[model samples]
Target chain A: MEPIKIKLDKSNELLTDLMPRKFGPQGRLWVGFLLLVIIIGAVAYYRQLKHGLVVTDMRDFTSWGIYISNFVFFVAISLVGSLVSAILKLTNVAWRTPLVRISEIIAVAAITFAAIIIIVDMGRPDRFWHLFVYGRIQSPILWDVIVITTYFVVSCLLLYIPLLPDIAVCRDTAPASPRWKKRFYTFLALNWKGTSKQYAIIHKSINVLAVLVVPLALGIHTVTSWLFATTYRAGWDSSNFGPYFVAGAFQAGCAGVIAVTFVLRNHYNLRKYITNKHFDNLGKLLVLLSLIYLYFNINEYLVPGYKMKTVDGEHLHSLFRGSYAPLFWSVQIFGMILPIIVLLFKKGRKPLPIFIVSILVVVGAWFKRFLIVIPTLLHPFIPIQNVPESWHHYVPTWEEWAITSASLAGALLIITIFVRLFPIISIWETTEEKMNATATQTGDQTQFYGA
Target chain B: MDEEQSNSRRSFIKTGLITGAIAAGGLGIMEVASQDTSKKKGDTVKLLSPDGKIVEVDSSEINPQIPDSLISTHNVREGVPGKKFVMVIDLAKCKNAGRCKSACSKMHYLPETRSYIKINKMQDSDKASPYWMPTPCFHCDNPPCVKVCPVGATFKLTDGIVGIDNDRCIGCRFCMVACPYSARVFNWDTEYQINVVRFKEIKEHAACSTHVTGTVEKCDFCPTKAAKNELPDCVQACPNGVFYFGDENEDVVSNGDETVRLSQLLKDKSGYRFLEDLGTKPRVYYLPPVDRQFPFKDVEPGTT
Candidate 1:
């Protein structure tokens, strides 16, 4: 089949209807809530700065805590953009068109926050520039910096390039916009005139970025995983870390896309454009990704679990039977296993159930990162001695919670601002898709008549 | 009036004797306000040579240089010239007395919870018996910490000791996390200046009067003493003379009074570097904990 096409006359109301709109009451409330969370988080960070890292419960032994986990969580979730858009596009998956824009948005939002959260985890955020000026190639942290910056740039361009035509639509149709808003739209549209040459360039650039970004996306999270894995600590010393982290990243990324897709579909009243068919396809993709992740997870844990080296045993015991057991199992089951079960059933694959499952998967993946970081540090081979007892255990204080929550809020605020300025779904892409679908239907009808 | 004048003279003589004891031992007074009695007349002293011949020399010739009466505190931190300092720890003598740990903590104003030095109870292999292994920063010739430091905050000194410039340290703790020996400690919380200094004249020397949060700390080897031509506090404080402070340039090491050739002492004691396989080439050599003065017994763990 050629493609499904919808009518796209210059005067078509759907074209104008889908242009970026001013916020309604619900949009206002959402923006307000995100702002509130961000402000609270900023205040918390201020306290941390004034009082020092003592505001957090992190001590010498468990030096890393939830902030680092949250950083991993953001990096993992950001990987979904490349998986959904680039990987699917490369493999000729037709259903990804509607889902692609939101995935890229989440990618940009999550990656931006990932960078922010990692800085927050630093004892001296002020000295972050030192990383660039004096970076050592041998350190895994430097590798992460290089790849993550590359991923962010690629993700932003992926989000931006295809947006030109849509921004043009917004520029032309936005009625009596403010002077600055008009200029903003016009500049962003890059004078895109829907010419064959412009369309061809836009499509080609998207293709190139999609291809370049996939490996870089994978590289970013893999390198982030190595920050821990490269060490000699019990839980971190894994040969399987690269693949394990990549699999987990795709799982979280796919789940994030699903959750964002659900919210966008409802918020924009885009039931017709997004459709049940799109959700069904997404549900299947998520289930398959979850299963693949589960396979890698087994490889990560089971092989080491069997041998039970002295250091490994201490670390595994904490996650499996000791203080961290509850979180450890819950992340495995709810983050991976339960989502897999839900996605298996057709009813569970529907939009509403899939949305709920995606939320569960995301929450579970966050805790999974926490399990990866904290427990390993706690189980350092040497006995903990000669320090205050508090140094032996890690518990996040209010300031840590505030700073961490603030980073999450900051990501949400970005998404909120993005939605306010541009249509969450691409109006121009949807119009083009509709036109192609109609043309294909007409071609099929002509074929039947000829036969 | 007469009694006060006599009291002042007696007190002056007492001061002279105390000053004479330290000055006579090559701790020179570079400047003295008193009139030069030696300039009035050429006084000569007779001394016997090692070969038992008598020699006559001017009294001034007995002292080659007038050392600074008081080495400036800032200058003391700069270390001595023309020597690269090194240390050797005799593991055989360490019974985990942990006096070195406490003294270092007190001097550096480290928090009670943080220790720059850790005494690891290391077992060579699964089947081998355990031994008490005290670990200071190996201060590796090719230090992993110096390599990973994003800022040049932690640097290796020309004298072979690695030290941190606290003002430059951003306290990322990357150095702490990177160190394989677990030799690095972070100031995760600010430390209270506990007034560790005493003596009115020396109070000005205490620049470590405040501890900033978010910096890394480790064993400095008391550069403060190396400038004074004295052994590091750890080398001096060890009752069993476990630590040997030396200059590799001179090929001589001394634990306070007994000085010996560095190469000779190492050869005699069969000194070895710890974790030799790691390729760090540690400055501190170790003497094995064999033929010990005391039997190995498990000490109950405590937050010393």
Candidate 2:
């Protein structure tokens, strides 16, 4: 809870250093690569639209495929915006200042794709308007649509309102920037001269949004989980799915932040700003989130393991010892248990080791969504019959893989582009923290002498 | 008054014969009218008018062709009033001939890959004897498909049949997941090989009963046939009299050849519904396979 103390000269140095910088050759290549991947995905999606959902490996048996899993992953990763910004801000956490913008950018990007991937999964995308034309309140899909859109709007506001002052700073400092870039910043900054009234309004709006985003973020992920849990299928039919999904989402979001922080720190050379202490703190938070998720995983799996209801028994067997066992156990051990074990130690909480652990958590979380979706569908109550042998199993086709990878790349591209335009770390907030620390330190010295 | 009645009755008979001839002959009314000019004028055929009153007219006046749009768009949602349809499968009579499956496939124009009525080989446990179980849509009173459909594309009618509106279905396939019976199938690819001409003919007879690409389809309990008081295709197609279709409200069911009181048949045969404990309240009941028609020899539970 202690504010970070810094000299005025160092504070000014941090501000100028963290300003939006021009992309170097490596940054240009990365953006180009992302664009190429996105184009490939668009082409694949075009083919899907031209033909139908038939291009995918999904059949009557495994009706939902990688598209849905990708959607869940996006929604999961997006929860970090609220966790790192809204939750930490409200709780008076001081160390979260450097990571907030990165998390919010990631959230906005991931959520944008989360909405798109859902449409990509639809059988009749042309008739998507039918959802609005004949939407029923009873359907969980409608609830998801409502909450996700609400979350997306709230998240965008949360990302943008805080960026106003920083945008003003970029506008004032970057006179040599491109005409369009200057115009963009000028228009976006709303002519802010850092007046006290302007600051008050901006602060009040952000505070209101920060409070609003927490429950909306929770609702977005909880409702995404409900899309599956509301169903009668054995693996998906559990009251624990809501909390299970939220916990897993927090874990995944924290891992995303850790991964992004490490990259941004190296790429932007902001080592002085994003210190090892931030990684250590995030590492500990990851441990707590992973533990909570592990508890839910136990609750999710144990009851079915104990009762072994005929339908549930078959589903659990597939995850525990049958076809999905490798992916299942790997997700459990590496994604949850190993991360928990590694991050619990001081040495492992260091930046390098923790980054590795975060990568494992992320990759494992992606496959965990896959395990949740595909396995249960394969073990329907009735045995698979009268269908082609290929229908008996699901292997996502190349087109499906292309589209799913494109969505992931698309999320990354959005983050990359946003970082190119703005500071990954909040300059105004960091400076405010430094000033507060100075005030607190002088007050402590005064008290010591008087006593 | 008597003389007037006799005149009207004669004319009604004449109209009835002309209409029937045109329908049976598949000849256009204009062709028939032109041909009638060369025929003998003395011939008279008995006919009845739709109004129950007879009106004398030349046979040439009969128009056999009805406008396609005049084909009634009877609200398929409101089923046959005052009727609760049910089916009772006599498992004791089934011998795995797959006649019901083929008949159902043919009647519904289902592709060779899919069958609306599937004949599953079932055994309760490893120690139990296996038997052929022909499974169709249970038409549950509390259907999970109807409940989960976001657009009300699939619905359970009052007549105990669950039907799908292909035009309205957004093809989410949530209903397929909700259905425990695995009765539903998606029209994944466009069925280009379907006999479009025959399909069109069938569509004229049945409202909202055309298949489309990317929508879910399943056994509809042959509501089209049921509306006509005719046996569903599977009921009539089962050579061994395995399927009985009837109105549960009347408590009578017929297996094409023989009619039986439903309550009495169930009482005598110890009938039960599939997965009764699931509380789906299926309209289809099964008489358990006892006193088997064929031995459970060399037959696997889920193999053709």
Candidate 3:
């Protein structure tokens, strides 16, 4: 980090505390577990490629199955990077220093898998190049492809640019490391000398990217919602879907960041950097997000429930009282309603309770996506007729479950490997914030910059 | 017209199966054992290929010309150049005989499990009487399926027909969800064994109707049949004259037995498109089931 005119002694301590480290036993087990799930998903995908989509239970009626829902989940979770690194950064949230890198990595991993799982859902993934070669601008799928690629590039840059100072710290301070790792950190450090001018440039670039990323993030998720909303299907035909999906995405992403932050804090002993105050702030943020998501949920469902058009009634009935009632009620109660209720109280905002609630939110968000995609498909304008009786219901085959679970595991694995490769919390940013706080509190003109 | 064509087809295949000089396309079992050899006499027959190249082959090797094979993929997607094809299903005459479904599967070489046409037993309300609705791809002017296709695999041609190019389709299934009619079906696992045989026997064609695994298929309005001024198989095979196929441009539609003016028929019978509020502007229209020929029987047609 360029130590500048500020304190260098505190930098040494923060650098030692925030540098990347090897995985402990639990971390190794977590990585191994994630790899195992990913391997099984690959094998299941092989079977799918060998047979056809027939291997899955998706037929003409429910053309999209769990793979699509999983895709939506990934897209939803990927929005956290924008929420933490961009939106929170722009607002100058005081406690957001340590949480930014974790959420950004989660966004990178989830968006990468979002792109992969969509290809997996394709009937002819081998012809994926045709999407680019013969792509029509009218289709939402092409829109998703373009925006998602843009978002991925922007997220990677957001993740990388902030890491240059930290990587330079690692390169200079990590003397016992292997040659390649030292070289790796050195190369990635981008010759950062932490000069006053370079700091200005970095701050300027971060600000520009931060502003650029928010709308792009909103557009990415809104375009994803359009993949369904643009169609004429009953549950999917709402004009309110764009904001509804974006709000729901923000909720999921917030919970995703909280859940990962809890694990990383406990596993890496990063309490000095992360602290309970960060979790408390995130818990309050999740509560706010969940309520906003609930507002959109009411708009999405209640307005249609009020009208109860003949076609939409069937879809609502299935969700409210029929086959899907159990899931619908459970996801609402446990995922959204319960988290909001629990996080509103002070004691519930503690690290452990909030972590459990965030897990529930993440799980609920996944099935909430399932509820969004599948119910509408089962109730089309035309009656299901002249087909086999089995087509009346959709149940994903084992291969579908395997592949979907693998995608989830694959995302976790990305975060896990990233932790080993670089610090999960930013070293330079945390040091700068700590020094600024000390300068303000103690009137320490000696350590203050431009003194 | 359908019976005549079926008989001619039966005799053609029967004759080819027995006689020594018979041919079954270019790749079929053609064990010609004629006493006079056309090669010795230097006899050659000039035939135009599907792509419009005139090639000369031995007289013995000339394939029986099926008009289906002659329409190239480019022709299939381009549609019948001059005609805006439309259909009117007379709900009054339909007894759910299911001849349309069978004929559609037969002509398209579809597997037994699936067909482009579905006979939906629909009742408008609790009080209204039920009728059989044979739904096909409506080929709407503002086709939802065409608009959602990411690769432009499905497109609305100038002739007002929506056609799908399986070769171009990436099998994303977005069009299937986009279509409110539920008309399209995926080739989840193709009838490849049967398609191999059909592809061989129809080798002289562009492999147009051969089903591809992981692609979407629907009622193409039989553009290949339209190329020859013949009705779609479903229209010609309906015994009760339940379906009327016509060119809207010509203002005429026929159900094999009777021909009528399009405007007059719709005006007189109060023919209407299904789900008219959706703004799809479907090409197919339906006449309300009034003055029915037979009672709305829920049982299978032949059982009673």
Candidate topping TM-score: 3
**Candidate 3 or 2, higher lDDT:** 3
List lDDT for all candidates, in order.
0.75, 0.81, 0.84
RMSD of each: 9.1, 8.4, 8.6
**Clash tally, candidates in order:** 11, 3, 1
lDDT of 3 by residue, A156-228 (tens): 9999998888787777766655788788888899898889778778888889999999999999999999999
lDDT tens digits, residue span A256-375, model 1:
888888987788877766777778888888889999999998888888889998879888988889999998998898888998898899999899999999999999988898899888
| Second chain TM-score, each model | 0.70, 0.72, 0.73
What TM-score describes the B chain of model 3?
Answer: 0.73
Q: Is candidate 2 or candidate 3 better by DockQ?
A: 3
Ranking, TM-score, top scorer first: 3, 2, 1
lDDT of 1 by residue, B1-304 (tens): 5335434643554477557743432212222213233333477889875456999978765432221222322321233445677788877777777666665666666654445667667676888667777777777887867766766777777678787866567666667655656777666665442433352245323323235467677777766566456776667766777778888876778877688778878898898987676576788888888777666666724344
For model 3, the docking class works out as: acceptable
The candidate that achieves the highest lDDT relative to the unseen native structure: 3
Q: Cα deviation in Å at residue A54, candidate 1?
A: 1.4
Q: Candidate 1's error at B246, in angstroms?
A: 3.6
The stretch of ten residues in a row with the least summed lDDT in candidate 2 chain A is: A442-451
**Which pairs clash in model 2?**
B12-B47, B13-B46, B13-B47
